[model samples]
Target: MEFSWLETRWARPFYLAFVFCLALGLLQTIKLYLRRQRLLRDLRAFPTPPTHWFLGHQKFIQDDNMEKLEEIIEKYPRAFPFWIGPFQAFFYIYDPDYAKTFLSRTDPKSQYLQKFLPPLIGKGLLALDGPKWFQHRCLLTPGFHFNILKAYIEVMAHSVKTMLDKWEKICSTQDTSLEVYEHINLMSLDIIMKCAFSKETNCQTNSTHDPYVKAIFELSKIIFHRLYSFLYHSDIIFKLSPQGYRFQKLSRVLNQYTDAIIQERKKSLQAGVKQNNTQKRKYQDFLDIVLSAKDENGSSFSDTDVHSEVSMFLLGGHDSLAASISWILYCLALNPEHQERCREEVRGILGDGCSITWDQLDEMSYTTMCIKETCRLIPAVPSIFRDLSKPLTFPDGCTLPAGITVVLSIWGLHHNPAVWKNPKVFDPLRFSQENSDQRHPYAYLPFSAGSRNCIGQQFAMVQLKVTIALILLHFRVTPDPTRPPTFSSHFILKPKNGMYLQLKKLSEC
Candidate 1:
């Protein structure tokens, strides 16, 4: 072969460089073989899944962007720990008592979750630990008391009623088939904004064109993508390598948006009346509570602190209910008889467009059961992360070292055939007061357990109850035959195809 003029001078250097790279690759391969021995030793020190030399058990949990961890965890059952590089973590904690210890602050195990989240969420009640978490939960408890939550009932009903109107329109024009999952997502977004921030997302009215909703939806999608990639690529590696810049840049964007919202809320509160003459001096939505919420000595929170919580509430509060109810709808569509039973129960409670109240909400047993069953089948946040501050031995004699990342596979707990009878079936009656008692105390924890559990649990349930109640009261939901949707797990478990359903106008009937 004749070499070109360009190849003559540089060809020798190029060939030499290639040879050097080949030699270096061989060296790394030998090092890799040595490293595998250490990895095996590391796993033996703690429980780990049957892991590979180079990747550990990373393959067992890889490429699960579709929110399939529940299925994965179920298969493993805690026989062996999952190996992720140097980290030996358990995929499922089979014992409820052990899982409870993992979720609490009082366990003396020294827990931490500060790695992936920003500082904004660090100090907030939902993510805080120890005394701070205790105090914050205490102070905020009254804010979501039964009566106080009752006040938000009207708002939730109106929001859901509005969604039903739009859904009716979509079902009407589109051959009785539409991917209504996107619509459900938008509806949940709107309800959260109204209840959490007192602002309307109007995603239903505008179909996801609003900037905040659009940004968050897009951001959530991107963040999930990054999270999936991060599982394969270590965080320390990311920080050392070029990928760290992407994490930094994206984190900055998220903080910027949250910061802006916090500032705007603060500005409104500072200018607005300090104390209103009516009832208590509370702000209408969560912003008022967040702005006015004080620490032990009565010092107000910083804008960043307030924003972090608002961001947490907005993200957790919004996404969770959306996933639960979307799953409820999907389940109902899959099993139409249950859908009729839910509707009949709602009608029995409401009767002729009557508004829902806390008392009325309490009486809707079937409605609550449906929500519980949906959560059982598909928990919104299916995994919980906790780190041990020191080597802590479990009651079962399993000891995990400090700095180990514990993945509390919730989907495993929710679907564990041992805890729940007919676990795979979509059965709401399992949650009725009598039957629900049969399950282990912590086994059915969709919102989780102990101190660090979701504070917005009640808030989410109330909002979901109203939304579900109103929709059933006014509309009859049937699976849209055209695109019959399935789930695509993102930040919130979303539908693969949109949840399209034919809404039979109940008033006409």
Candidate 2:
């Protein structure tokens, strides 16, 4: 009788605990079901492609599905519902009027991005929202002022020349076509190191062995892969995975590098080193500006804030710009006539001088048009994402609730048949002054649009013009007929098979 009573007491508690857990789980499942149903009802107004009950539209949205996406765009016109999973769906927008209306709003960035980016970049200006974002934006504005950007032109030209010299040596020795993306990536990294941190890394030459460069590249791949893999979204599951382990290791290397620079700069500032060496320096780099900036109330960024901003700028400044320059060269190779015109225009302004000036950048109008057109067809950054903070009503009278996630498809908008008269054609004349004036203001958002546009746009433009002009001055680029590129879009738009072109050295005038 005593043993029976003891067993009953223990078994009763166990049974109750099991019952409680089962009830809780049942309630949560029902809650999710209701939420999904509500989302479907709200989004019923927009046309969507067929979706799996479990997979949603995941199969059709891979990086290589551009043709499928284009077909859907043609069938659906302006906007459509994109379901990522059984419960989560976002509106994919492509029309210019719809894009303008959506981008002009003050909605915060998508919560989806917030979950993934913080592990890599921390909560910098790219990820921040509300009053905090505004504060950081104001503090960092002076770093990109015209005077500062003008000074960076010299740094940019030096980096470009370094890459060109290496290419000249390679081309002289062999007749093989060159894969230019990796080379351009290193050059872009070198420019950012010199222009932003005032450090000359020589990464363009030693990229194979550079720890910081390797870490940045690996970490970018891991983050992009994690974003697409739904199973890796959970913190507990990701923490135990192979990618998560690699991410942690690479992040330590990157953080250590950034921290060392911050500490060195801090020590220099304390000793009055930078302030005392005014004659040696023509202008301040991004590090000096951010370290010294103060808000209206004399507030400055914390050490954590400084690290986040530095890392964000370091990553953002290089990758997209590299993609832009590579695609521009590829497009020029495909159209030799356009290439010759751009080369002529560049030579006319530069006139045997390798040194590019700020004024000369303005004179290469045809070259600038070519760059803009390339961006339209293959935008470096293809899409911008946002989450509505309040109900948004489109120009067509369609309304999205506050929590809806929206993707502004820059690629689709640029290719929209309604917006451009022959979207597929590589026509630089489409960007002429008269033609550009008649287009919608929201059209041609290679660097994005609105109040939250890219902070370093002027810096990027100067770098592109300087790099391309110097490259054209040195080599005559032609497409390799044996190897054509396949386009893919992850974090940035890139050629799947790598960008290869033949480089014939130009005879000196």
Candidate 3:
């Protein structure tokens, strides 16, 4: 009876449909298996640690274990690969030869960064790619020229003085160990606000904090938390979660604050208060310069684009500079011998004066070497991310296909025994002219290298030189032995606990 029913007109069409669906499913399964097999075969050439066949290496990296991975890199020097599941793989490149080749090509940023940051940073130069990124880079390059950075030295010095004033007040009352990172963070925020937007955020002066600063700080925490949550990488899942809601709220606060600042600047420029023909004017600030820039297509940034770029600069500048400055201080505190040498160099140049002029900053050569060594040992950004836009062949002739994500571990590169001698020691003289000449150009990448390097290198170097020169003048900093900082892996390099320093007045010294 069933066979006879299948032979009928209605049954025949139903039978045909059923067979068609079955064949389609079988074909899809075959294609998936073939693709998986090919990915597995392609990954076999690279070296990987012991991993779960089902879970792959995902189980080992459930948390941030970059400190552990540094050990593994020593064993697998060519390139270390990690499998996410059965097929997906990532390469952590620690060798300079590999880093140089990869960075020389303008591959788009790692997919992981693009996924997490655009929500916070939008299409800013840090996150933008292709024609858009190039355009924005060109537009903003002029704002960071030497003349503009030189004019900002006064602003940086003022912010540093404000920080020192607070420190002095505390030291005068009682000699106590102070947590300096918090103070440095606020000071960096204040400096960036003044230098980038020509506004005094008063983060250093006001006891009542700025809401924008608080929101920015909290947002960074939220964003970093979301980035490591692999299950929440999906947009729909993340949006439905609690971190997502908090991220949205914090982002709104940040956007509102930046928008207000942008509008205020625009109004001031329109009213001609920002620039005047009759009065002698100072250099144009970053905000004014960015507002006046246009692309090759004769297009100016839209209000939204302007907001993104400003927010990018604000967020990028604040935390990274703060961390770098705090670590520089911490390194000096631990190595008092180096600290005194730098102080003597500064005293030789400035003669008990706290203020640093642009030309005077260049004369602090030993101090600059110490800063370079500090950066090499503990880079502000421990590792940077990249994605392969095309197949890449390393110096060893090992080839990686397109779409492979990589971590260029600045931490590993600095510590590699092949490149550095006595890598663990605090030797600032390694950066002297003769020693530096013997090193590979790509070996020390504090600000990274190649065409896509940090745009604020000049600004950051100036800020560091000024703050360091001033602090050494006023205070004798020593480490708190009880509370030594352990390096922690975060989006930016950070201390596991905190940085506590004993600040003795120079007169007491």
Candidate 4:
């Protein structure tokens, strides 16, 4: 009787539940196995458009000693795809307006640049979200103000003179023309050091000896450097192996340098040197403002916080300036008529002075256009990254699955002929008020757009104008006929080799 009752009520249901669980478990097991296999054979299984698995398309973006990528970007104006690890991303933006809107799209909390920036910018003004970023921006505004930038004009003039003085010595030697990029790099580096870390640095005279500043140079090498710097090549075999000692070695050196600078600045701040003799400080260095920066409830930044923020500015503000100036000079060399027009404009305003005041820099509207056009073709920070916050549809009517990274193809969009007339041609006139005013708002994104546009945009423009004016005033630059010059693509776009140019002394107007 008991067996019959149990069979009638419990047996069927228990059997059904057991079968259901078994089916679920089997499905999960199969899914796990497939995922593992996918991870193992990721390089082979992915549908990529014709690229060697070993190099993938990294050699195109991360090219070593080649001008090929720069030419390739302009040469091929279409959608391209590349792999970064197991993830595949699209670089299909050739239309300028599309590029603009994609980058500008932001979330409710803050600007949308947390993904790529986390590895570099951290919780600084650049990568912070909502309240944190807004506070940081407000606290830091006093640092980049016009009156503050004006304080550092003399240092720029001095730096320019030092560069010219050094160049004069080098050019005097028989067949001794110098690498233009290196000089600009040094000039920009020196300016950033003085303005950013005026505590106890003489990067102007002795960068090689100063370990802290020297380490800052090495930091860039560690992050976004050429493969030549890597001790071991990455692969499936390497990924499964034990962590290498090389990673620790590079990390320690960079961390120690940043820590030291940050600590010193803290002590200096606590000592309270906010003002100087005669009841006025002549210059407003980065530290001066950062030290004074007080967040909500009367709190200031920690040492590590300041360290990361300072590092970000040095690389973005200074290094980019150098790269841009070098490329702009290169373009001017290739297009002498444009160079003559630029010089004529400069002459009309300053009458061939070695330098211009920040006010004068504002007045040179045409010069600004030429710089914008150069950056349009050759942007310093080459890539824009935005991680999808939610499953959303683009204007193209494609619903992207959530958790995918969006890589805006800056290089492809820059040369898109649909938005830009005669895209291949280097025409500053394209930026004329009539032309740009009518074009789609997204057509030109040299400084990027929306919430996360470069904080130091105006500051950098001043730096570029000052440096470019100085170079044109003293020298008429022409391309070296001996060898074809090319640019190498990196995290920052740089020359394939050092910029070799023929610089002849210019006559006074």
- Highest lDDT among the candidates is held by which one? 2
Per-residue alpha-carbon lDDT of candidate 2 for residues 1-509, written as tens digits (9 for 90 to 100): 99999999999989999999999999988997998999989898887988888767666656568778788888888989887778778789999889889988889998888887765678899998889999999999999998999999988988888888888888886665999888898899899988888887888886645787668667766776666666677788998998889888888898999899889888888898886653466778999989889998999999999999998888788878988999999999999999999999988899885578899999999999999999999998888889999999998899898999899999889888788888889999999999999999887898888889999888888889998998998899998889888876677777766799999988442
TM-score of each prediction = 0.81, 0.95, 0.89, 0.79
Top-down lDDT ranking: 2, 3, 1, 4
Weakest ten-residue segment in model 3 by summed lDDT: 274-283
lDDT of each: 0.66, 0.86, 0.82, 0.64
Clashing pairs in 3: none
Which ranges in model 2 have alpha carbons more than 4 Å from their true place? 1-14, 276-278, 507-509
Supply every candidate's count of residue pairs whose N, Cα or C atoms clash at under 3 angstroms: 13, 0, 0, 0
Higher-ranked by TM-score: 3 or 4: 3
List, residue by residue over 93-138, the lDDT tens digit for candidate 1: 6456667767753432213234445422445775676676666677
* Candidate 2 residue-wise lDDT at 307: 95
RMSD (Å) per prediction: 5.7, 2.0, 4.7, 8.8
Model 1 TM-score (2 dp): 0.81
Most TM-score-accurate candidate? 2
Could you give candidate 3's per-residue lDDT for residues 1-509 as a string of tens digits?
98777579577788899999999999977886786687767667887788777566655344556556667767776567766665456677889898899889999998888877765677788888888888999999998999988988988888888888888888996677998887888899898888778886777878436777667666666666655555566688988888888888888888888889899988877888765621333767778878999988788888878988998888777878888998999999989999999999988898857456889988999999999999998998888888889999998898888887887988889888777887778999999999999889899999999888999898899999998988998898998988887765566776656689999877421
Model 3 segments more than 4 A misplaced: 1-39, 52-66, 84-88, 207-210, 276-281, 507-509
